[model samples]
Target: MPSPEPDDLKRLAERIDEAERKHAQRKKPPPPTSLGIAFRFATEMVSALLVGGGLGWGIDWAFDHWSHLQTRPWGMVVMFVLGAAAGIRNVMAAAKELNAEMAAKDLEK
Candidate 1:
């Protein structure tokens, strides 16, 4: 077999270096728009509320049927409030993350 040409090897090394540079430079995802942020917050809150309410409903049903206890509306109400608190917490966490991201971008510039 013939040995590779030096010119050919040089070109190949340059191409490999270019490709590596391109690969190393990752594209960041676009920041969320205001509407997107709003939707995210809303979804978080609604999903939490639904999960909490469902759990409460299940608890009430189980107590009423299995143990001769009646929880009914009170259980639902308490769970709903807890769910609201959880949702608020989620929103705050999301907001903090976004703020940090924004600060990072600002620092980069």
Candidate 2:
């Protein structure tokens, strides 16, 4: 067989490059599904709430043990409210971070 010309070789190389680009794209992983997103959001929110509530309970117990001043469940109630607020704040911050990360990844594609 006759040797291929330089022009033919160049065209072949171009075709190979294009094919490789396409192959790489196909190999890329798919984005997370709706269910996965929902699970992550739920996990983040619930974990924050639990931690906050636990802290509130701990605070109330510590105050009960103190002998200097009389106290009731008021401390527990207030701390619980504060804990809930903190949980909400944490969840919001986490959601914002996740959204930014997703945006960055999307831009990469």
Candidate 3:
């Protein structure tokens, strides 16, 4: 068999270097998005508030619509307060969850 030329050896050396570089490289995962986390947090907080208010309104309607019943918007007012509390609670929970996730990621690194 004929020996390889100088040009061929140079090309082979370049290919080996390229292969070694690729072998030494590691794949990095993409970071989690803050927008998505914020959206979920907001959604949880808002939905809790909305659902609480809605249920309160429903109770108020039931009381008013019944015969021989006289109740002011007190149900709505009370429910509104409860809903606000629930929203606050949900927001706190979301914050805790996010913090935990971040802590876990830091530990990973």
Best by lDDT: 1
lDDT of each: 0.88, 0.74, 0.83
Better of 2 and 3 by TM-score: 3
TM-score (C-alpha, index-matched) for candidate 3: 0.65
Angstrom error at residue 1, model 1: 43
lDDT per residue (tens digit) for residues 1-109 in model 2: 8887999989999999999998887444566777887787777667766776677667767777866544456666776677677767876886797788789788987
Per-residue accuracy of model 3 over 1-109 as CA lDDT, tens digit each: 8776999989999999999999998875566698987888789878978887788888888888884565557777788789888988888988897788788779978
Candidate 3's clash total is 0
User: What TM-score does candidate 1 get on C-alpha atoms?
Assistant: 0.76
TM-score-wise, the better of 1 and 3 is 1
- What is the lDDT for 45 in model 2? 69
What are the runs in model 2 whose C-alpha is more than 4 Å off? 1-4, 12-30
In candidate 2, how many clashes are counted? 0
